[model samples]
Target: MLNQTPLWKYIMVLMVVAVCTLYASPNLYGEDYAVQISAAKDSTVDLNLVDRVNAQLEKAGIETKAVALENEQILIRLNDDSSQRLAREALESALGRDYIVAMNLAPDTPEWLDNLGGTPMKLGLDLRGGVHFLMEVDMQSVMTKSLKDMEGDFKTSLREERIRYRRVSIVNDVVQIQFRDQETLEKAEFFLKNRNADITIVEQGELTLVASMSETKLAEIRDYAVKQNITIMRNRVNQLGVAEPLIQRQGADRIVVQLPGIQDTARAKEILNATATLEFRMVDLDHDVRDAVNGRVPPGSELINDQQGVPQLLKQDIMLEGSHIIDANSGVDEYGMPKVSISLDSAGGSKMSLGTKGNIGKPMATVFIEYQATNEKNADGKIIFVPEREVVSVATIRAQLGSRFEITGLDSPKEARDLALLLRAGALIAPITIVEERTVGPSLGQENIDLGMQAIIWGFVLVLAFMLVYYKAFGVVANVALTANLVMIVGVMSMIPGATLTLPGMAGIVLTVGMAVDANVLIFERIREELRDSRSPQQAIHHGYDSAFSTILDANITTFIAALILFAVGTGPIKGFSITLMIGIVTSMFTAIILTRTIVNGVWGGKRLEKLWI
Candidate 1:
């Protein structure tokens, strides 16, 4: 009974190993070379596209393992790398310029295992090969936009307070108020300074007041712009069907994005760089569209073309900004036509309600505004955004629409879905330009994977050989636990969402193989000490494990703390390394202590041995 483990503990141990082994087995099956097809914004993806792809592959004499349509994309698996390249070329030629055809590696996970929520660990950009972008937020544009909004608010507030102002305009990132007299200027300055804590008010002259954001406020604006752009970029990247994307703030006004397993850089750039928003404005029913088109636009109306290229007149004042939209979904209308249902926030609802109160019968136009980069670059080596506005929908106000509404007259379901996706991705607070971009090819990624695997395998083999020769029979037990430790690490990584293994992460795994046997070494040495002191084998094993527990706990806890610190403070590859190190520490502790002890106890627990093999 000295070293005996409880029956329940044995069952628990076996159950854990079984589950881990089952999950970890998927990685052994390897991956397949595949080509993926994604539809453009106006195009649609269906089973027909899959059939066409198969037909093209067949015509090209390219053998394909399988073809499946999933998540609005067609994935065609090929037999080898040659077939993959040939299929990609053939499919791209067949699909023309309407679809994005890219090479990818698809996991060959069995259907049953996939259904059971079993998946291989996700590889990072460095391991799987993808595109990396370093984007810089336009802080100047951010400040300008903020000042413009503040200028509008200031003008509205002064008019409501009966404080007459000659003009309220934004100049050089500051809101300037030109009042007719000093009394009105003082009143406006006092009101604005008290109302907005983030801005500082300065009396410029006898009848002028200047309001600018404080330094702290400016810093906050820059930080918030970068963070918000990162979030929106992440949402947009989801449409690319990337498995694990890394989007994070790099500096004060820059973000680092890594898209793993994405070979279509053009499509990725289109999705990430595109900025779209919707504006709700009253249509100018009194103004003639022919006159507006001929450059005789009304005083407060602007001429814009709809999606169909027809000119229309609309009020310049925006009743609701796209930022007020909370959610959007694509669905069929009552007449079975494609439509997009949109929900607004509280402020947006109030604005819509008030704006539509007196204009029930008037038509409201939903103006779609997109800022696209031009082919020309500015002096600062940045692309300039050209503003493109079009009226996507013009609907009559059936009643006072508030909070929720639907935009009908969509050309197709694909258009509706795309509009919904754009709305759901949210509007960028400020435009961003990619300052640097790098693409990691699949061959290099495979090379990294091979090297990483070699490091892990060699390290494991060395450790296994050493333990087997030194401790003999007891070393075999340690090796078993060590194998279990590795399995559990991979299993846990696969189970956790957003946990990606990078090159440095593989190094962490290799290091874990070396460090995993430390506890076993301590236990075996302690048992030798106990046995030399004339204790029985069972007593030596029990006392050795009991005494070694404290040392193992302290050592592993300290290392784990370091790993946590690294994870908290590090970025990108450092973070990946820290994750694996932390996970390895945990799994190693469990396997080396509890698991190895269980084996030792069950095998040689109640025996009286004359000699010990350890």
Candidate 2:
């Protein structure tokens, strides 16, 4: 009974290997080129859209393997990249701007596996091929927006405090306020200083007071903008249905985004660069829109076009910005009409409640603002954002609306869903300009994958030959365990969410192969030492495993700690490496100790042997 294993251990090892094998089988099916058609702001994607897509492809003589409508998007699977490109071009030309025609790689997983919630391992940009963008946040716009908000706060605070001021305006990057007297200036300065801790307050002479952000505050603002933009970008990219995307901060004000298995650069760029937000403002019914259109715009109002391109006058003061919106969803009203349900934070709820309390039956306009990059580049070779504003909805307040409200005058369900998506994605703190863009072709990705696999295969072959030649029968057990270890690694990775495999991750896998065999080497050497002590085969096997347990634990635990640190502090490729390293350590430990011992026990346990193959 020295080398005998418990029945439960055998069952656990078999169950793990079987489950891992089942989950890891999906990777064998590979992927297909798919043309994805998503409804734009004004378009609808239903069965009719799928029919139209099929018709358009047929008319263009493009062959498609399948067409399906899912999640309000049409997915058309094609035979090759050439067909995908051709189909996308034809569909784009036919659909115009109503739909976003993008190309992606769709998994060819079988229905049974899919039904079981099985999916292929997520591949990184380098392995699967996609677009990479290096974006720089417009920190100047961030500062300007901050200054404008401060200017509003300053005016409101001064008016509430009964302090007289000629005017408060943001000139350049500084907030300038002209007070009537030195006493008012001193009082206002104290109030503003306490309220605006991020800004430095300066009194110019006796009547003018200027406030600007400190250098440290500016840096903090820029960093926050970059980080916030990264989060928003990640949310927006979810619309692309990417499995695993990389959106992280790079340096001070830049972000790096990599979208794997996406081939539509134009649509990806549009989604990433789009800076959409909603603003609720009072409809300036006191001002005549005709006069504003005639270039006689009012001082405290602005003329803007609605979604139909009709001009309307709106108050310059914003009641609520999109940033306050916490949740949004597309649904139907009591009359079953399409509407967007919106929820706001406490501050936004208070602001809305106060703003609408006095304006019962008054018209409130929901202004949609978007900042787009122009084709023109500046001297610094960065794209400039051209601000475009439009009134998307104008509705009369029926009651005092607070945190929750609905926009029911949408043109279609698609519009409602789009508005909800924009609200949920959250507005970017500032516009982002793509300073660098790169596309990785599928062929190149396949080549890299091939090279990585080649390295793994050669390493595996060399290890197998050495073990078989030296350890004989015991080497066969180690190789089987090694294979099972690899399977479990892939299985665990596929099971986990957001665990993507990259090139560096492939290197980690290769490294794991060597480390896994090293564990076996330690046990085999320990067994050899026991044999030299004149112990029987069963005694040697049991003592070898028992003696090597502590050494294996110490070594693997140290390596695992390093992997954890790498995953904690590292980004991008380094993180990829760390993830695989950590997973490999876990799986290898199980295979090397539990699995190999189980197999060995089943083979040679409770046997009286004079000599051992090992």
Candidate 3:
């Protein structure tokens, strides 16, 4: 009775280990090098598309293992990396822009295991080889835009308050307002200072009020811009079909993005580097477009060209931004032409209502704006990104509009669909330029996996050997628990959707093996001490486990807290390592204390012995 474990508890422990083992089995089957073919906006994937792909691959003399349609897409399994590359190139060339033929890794897990919701833990970029991008938020652009917005707000506020000002402009990064006289300027300064505490207002000359944001306010803007861009980048990355992409803030103004399963760096860049947004503004009906084109651009008006190269004068004031769009769907309208139905958030809806309530029968143009990075650098050694604006759609407001609207001037369904996708993904707050980019091939990822696996295997084997020789009978029990701990780690990682296995995470597993045995070491030493004090084998074993548990629990809880901190503050690989370390801590605790004790009691408990093997 001293060392015996309850029969029901023993069965429960076995059941847990068995379930973990079942989930862990999928990782062993590995993955296949394949290409995924899916439909684009104006294309469809069917048997005919598959036939065309087969013909192209055959013509190119590329060998493929199999081509099958699954999940509304076509998956072509290839022999190795070479064939995967060739197959993708051939398919892309044959399919043209209509279909998307991207590199994909198909899981080779058995159908039965897959049906039971068993999946391998996803690999990180470092372990799986993909594209990595280091993007820097354009803080200069952020400050400029913030000041521009502030200038607009100030003008609007002054007009609403009936404060007279001759002109309000931004010069040398400072917003300067020339008032009619000192009384108005003084009133404006006092009103602005009280209304916008973050904005610093100063008297410039006799009748001018100069305003600029305080340092703290500027810093807040920069932080928000970076954070917002990171959020938008995450939305864009989802559209790229990446499984485990890492997008995290790096330093103060830069972001690091790692796509673990993507091999196409060009496609990723095309989506992430450019910031595309929509601006809704009233068409300048009162201004002559020809006059504005002749170097006479009106105040608060801009001359923007449409897609057909027609110069159109539009109001500079923005009614709504694309960032407020909550949803968009592409379809045909009454004339069977392409259109996009849009839905806005509550604030956007209110703003839309305000902008359109009095502007009925007036045309509102949707300007598609994109910031593209150029090869030239500015004085700050940062890449220059130029904005490209084009009026894509111009529709007259028939009635008061709220959250819902439709754009009908799109040239094709493809364009309509693309517009909808971008709107749904949300727009970047500020432009971001790719300062650095690198692509990791699957081969390199495989090499990393192989090396990481070797380290784990070697560390594990050494641990097993050391335990067996030093502790003898109890060492065998410890080794069994160690093995179970490793299995449970993999199983738990596989079961958790957010857990991704990286190169550094494997090192965590190696560390866990040692910690798993350390608990057993404490218990065995306690047992030896009891035996030396002339205690019976059964009593020694009982006191040994009971006494060591407290110390083990204390050590593990502290270590678990440390791991949590690392996970909370760390990024990328550090996060991956911390995650595995945390999982390993929990599994090791169960195996070393409860599991190993259960095993030890069942093997050597309730024995009458004078001496102990441990």
Candidate 4:
């Protein structure tokens, strides 16, 4: 009669089958030496662009692995692993043809992906060669948006109800409105509540109405802002060609972003930090900057530009701040001048509509940027106060915008393109200085890989010899499982997206190989003890596994806890080590506890009498 194998044996066989089937194929991995073409951020992308570009590459006899569209960017993979010239040419052609916004090459494709493909699980920056960014959210902007919304609602409701207010001001989180009397304040409060305004009346003095946005409403606004931040971060990371980046809230007003295998750290930083605002403001038809620079203006006032090609003079008022800008991009105007295309939100569109209505025939200057020259407050003193301001005009803005906007006095084409990328990403709150930067050249990575391979080979030889001697025949079974375990781990790693196999992580895998055999050692030793006590072969096998289960569980559980600790506290490569260590512990335990036992039982369970080896 056929007796079915135990549950553990079935699982082990299934795992062996899966590992073999998944990793044994050649085309499972991504192509080597491939360049990725992407879109400029905040710009729409056409998915069919990949087919068009691939058609061109195919003519060159280059086979592409896959064409993936993520975050509106098309990623093209091809052979010729180190053909930078070819990659650059292909990328530029694609960009010139409007197939992609930008193109870049990761020094190397992810090692595991190169051998295994099809949506591999991506690794985080800590586990791969990538960028880690800690970005500070503009809480002030969030609060300001809330205030503005509150003010708009208040003004609209007051006007409709005929409630006259002498003044309205927002200080701290409170909105203070000075009405004529207490009756007016009470009436205004009633009107506000009736209109369903999310405001709380804090004080109603003789002629003042103090109302504040509700705490719940403020919290809701903050939550909304956080959601927006996540969306923006995801969009930016995708555009940068990062695989499965992790962008999550670290604190109330901070986001923690982890990008894997991103070569351009500065570009990644720029993308994550940009606040893409697109605004159209009329040049102050009132002021002249040329005259002011020549000492024709008043004591403290300055000149600036509007959306149209004109200069204006007034108090430096940002009528519509960055929050209203929905999107922006760089393009060439009809005159072949570099210009930025912008889209406004409904409120901004309304303002723009009103500002430009019937004023098209008149001059309308677009102020591209605000330039404040760096100078000492007292001509060589240390104290730095924003010294002077000048508004850039439509023509100046166009010239300065670069590839995205051609700034008039760009030093070179490179400078123009860089500025264009910056604008597409968004404007920064302040200048972000790179205090630290390190580039990992391909040569360095290759050297590390060579050393890592040598170490792995040595480690495997050592573990195989150790297992062969200690457990004897049973030890050989353990070695087989260990070999298969290594293969499965590699296959699994390759299958994971963004999973980078760094040197430290490889070390973790080596360490796991020894640990993988420990469970088999425990079980085998238990079986030997049973045999020594004259137990039957079947009883020996049963008791061995039953007695060893708790020991293996406790040992692996402690190791898992340690790995988790390392993952939580460590950063970069150390964290990579922790992740691999944790995964290895799991896969090893499975192979040892399940796979080793089945082979042992099948081989030695019935034949071994106490006299054979004891």
State how far residue 396 of model 1 sits from its true place (Å): 6.0
Reference-based TM-score, model 4 = 0.62
Judge candidate 2 at residue 443 and give its lDDT: 88
TM-score of each: 0.88, 0.92, 0.82, 0.62
| lDDT tens digits, residue span 1-614, model 4 | 11225777677687664864465333244334445665542233566666766676766656666667644556665555444346546656655633333334433345564445434434434334455666655555568656765665566457656789887777777778888778888787777776555667755666777777677887877776776667655756766665566666665666677665665565565555444432234444456667765768754344653324354654332334344455665555566655555555676555444434434544433334422324444343322223123233233321211111123333333334444554444432321122234444445555666677788888888888887887788778888888878776776665655455667888998889878877877888898898888877677777888899999999899999999999888765777788778878977887887777677666665563544232
Using TM-score as the yardstick, the better of models 1 and 3 is 1
- Clash totals in order: 0, 0, 0, 39
Candidate 1 TM-score, true structure as reference: 0.88
Candidate 3 C-alpha lDDT tens digits along 141-254: 888877877777777678767898998899999999998887888888889999888888999797888899999998898898888788889977764667678888988899
Residue 420 of model 2 has an lDDT of 84
Where does model 4 exceed 4 Å of error?
A: 1-12, 15-17, 20-31, 41-82, 85-128, 132-134, 156-174, 189-206, 211-228, 246-258, 265-270, 277-457, 496-504, 536-538, 561-578, 608-614
Candidate 2 regions off by >4 Å?
A: 162-164, 289-296, 330-362, 377-381, 395-416, 607-611
Q: Judging by lDDT, tell me the better candidate of 1 and 4.
A: 1
What's the C-alpha lDDT at position 173 in model 3?
96
Please, what are the lDDT tens digits per residue for candidate 2 over residues 443-494? 8999989999999899989998998888899999999999998899898888
Q: What's the C-alpha lDDT at position 167 in model 2?
A: 88
Error of 2 at 34 (Å): 1.4
Return model 3's CA RMSD, one decimal: 4.7
Best by TM-score: 2
What 10-residue stretch in candidate 4 is worst by lDDT? 397-406
